[model samples]
Target: MPNRCQRLLAAILLFAAPVHAETLLCHVTYGGETQDLEARPVSSPYTVPVQPIGSYFLFRIVFQKEPADLAAIKLYVFADRDSGPLPIQQATHPYPPLAGKGAGFGFTGLNQVYEPIRDGELQYWCEWSPSSGPAR
Candidate 1:
């Protein structure tokens, strides 16, 4: 009997373990092409390297992780360059019945461009957006 109970407990534990989000999908438009980038988690202010495209000094975008729902993630942005229009964007997800499952939901940033990398530092800043949501 004890053996059977242990087996059941093990099964329950296995299923109860949290399945962390595997990748944070960030979409951006570059040269009219929808580019898909996988975001890596970082400490402090959110930061992600992006491919350079245009003359725009500031970029704003949305990034998301799946298995998530109605909620959004809020954060501030900081870079080696000047990023203005502070007090970064706020939560926009408005589903009253569900909490998001993944990270990077409704995340917005006023990223600074680091174009033309110097001394091994990042030279491009990518701002993810909602239109760039997880899809092909």
Candidate 2:
């Protein structure tokens, strides 16, 4: 009887374990140089930071996991401006992306973003996967 109870408790605990977290990874390129950007689930999109890409563009990514049914990932691109950053483009994808492992969904091909004023070209692609550990 004691062994049966122990097994039942273990089964309950196993089912209650949280799902593994997911990660969004992107490779951004500008002016002959490339850099990697990573984002994890966050409660608030406002907490994410805008990253600079080369001299003319700023990039931002947001991953939301709460309200589980509406989980989503968003990507934003901005053109650097003297007064502030100007929004250029935005992309959103439903969580657990339609693609299977090793295949990521994003702006179809080599996504090219242009800064209206400087005419600078920035390219980027992104993928999502179950978090294995610390980001690279």
Per-model TM-score versus the true fold? 0.29, 0.74
The parts of candidate 1 lying over 4 Å away from their true place are: 1-21, 46-53, 57-136
What are the lDDT scores of the predictions, listed in order? 0.37, 0.79
lDDT of 2 by residue, 76-133 (tens): 9998888898899997777766563233434323578987877778988876668644
**Model 1 C-alpha lDDT per residue in residues 35-104, reported as the tens digit of each score:** 4455533332235333333433223223434325523333222222445333322334221213333343
- lDDT for model 2: 0.79
Q: CA shift at 98, candidate 2, in angstroms?
A: 1.9
Q: Which ten residues in a row have the lowest lDDT in candidate 1?
A: 119-128
For each candidate, C-alpha RMSD in Å? Answer: 10.8, 6.3
